[model samples]
Target: MSDDGVRWLDEDQQHHWRALVMGTTLLFDRLDNDLSREHGISLAEYEILVRLSEREGRRMRMAQLADSMAHSRSRVTHTVGRLEKSGLVERIKSPEDGRGVVCAMTEQGWELLVAMAPTHVRGVRDNLVDLADPADFAAVGRVFDAVADHLVAAHPEMEIRGH
Candidate 1:
């Protein structure tokens, strides 16, 4: 195709794409706000807990955690500080490396996550999962998962680790 004649989305496709973008943004916003209001933790905080819960020995190196979560190291640092203040996470000096920090989930954090898990699950079910027909939901998830994987794999220099 000539550069000037390159095809663009049809009007209908553009409109549908925009709608999907807006809806997804709003869905996330609602979930974040709802969790913050109900559980006294922001969505990011909840995610950190989930990640830590899934990690080996319920802990992760700060750098690795940040990379896995696709968060800037500074943002992870700040989030971890907040979690520490809440007695949910504890930072320990890494035994393997002098300059590295390991974030370990405290008992309190585990308990909190256990308590919040149901609520978050319900929120996800209610807001997005329940709204779609089962087959469509599975199809949509698969589509987006492939899209994200391919896009990340294409960007060799991206900071996201093991994505």
Candidate 2:
């Protein structure tokens, strides 16, 4: 700790931290651009589609979807609205309860997802996965898992496990 009681990162730590930031920014931009150019979808929208596909019946409640993605409800709503406009997804009243809304993937959405899966996976592998040794990539996963767990612990409402 310094005299003012601040515990700043050391030189190596600073270097690594900056690298993480820059790497993530560039990697995400590249992935987003690839998807946009080839498939005409943004990475964020693709992530929503992927999440919905992983759920039972290819649907999830709006609130659950937002929580699962660590996004705000309004943001999810807006994105889903755009998807609905494109005929990719539909928002319906939740069957479990008549109150909440559920976002369901349409057949068109499923087909598009199927078609774009390869492009997305290739982009991921080309940009990130294949760049690191298996053990080093596994370590990166572990580090992010710990970071997510710690952050979510402090905000229990944002926790998405088992949802």
Candidate 3:
């Protein structure tokens, strides 16, 4: 412990922390830029689309989508609004809960995803997957999974879901 009674990271911890931060920043930026340049959509938009596609009837509640994406509800609303304007998604009343809103992928959106999937997969492989050992990637996934679980447990109201 230091004078402040703080337990600082040891050398190995410092190295891993720095690597994780830098790697995540560079990797996400690269993926976002690549998606924007090639598909006219940001990585965030692509994630929304993927989440919608994964759901039954290609739709999910706005709040649920926001949670799944680890984005704020307002941010998801804005992003969805942009997607709605682009004819990629539609906002509709939730059938289960009339007052709630649901976001559904449009046919055009599905088509767009189909067209862009290959490029996005290739970009992912090029930027991340191909660079890491399979075991290391699996370990990374487990690490984040545990982190998410801990955080959600600590703050249940601020729910976070894996996409």
Highest-TM-score candidate: 2
Clash tally, candidates in order = 0, 0, 0
Better of 1 and 3 by lDDT: 3
For model 2, how does the per-residue alpha-carbon lDDT over 67-112 read when each residue is reduced to its tens digit?
8788999999999998899899999999977999999999999999
- TM-scores of the candidates are 0.86, 0.94, 0.91
Worst 10 residues of 1 by lDDT: 154-163
Sort by lDDT, top down from the best: 2, 3, 1
Q: Using TM-score, rank the candidates from best to worst.
A: 2, 3, 1
TM-score between model 1 and native: 0.86
Worst 10 residues of 2 by lDDT: 154-163
Reference-based lDDT, each prediction: 0.86, 0.89, 0.88
**Candidate 2 or 1, higher TM-score:** 2
Please identify model 3 stretches exceeding 4 Å from their true place.
154-163
State the lDDT of candidate 3 residue by residue for 67-127, as single tens digits. Answer: 8777899999999999999999999999986999999999999999898888789888998
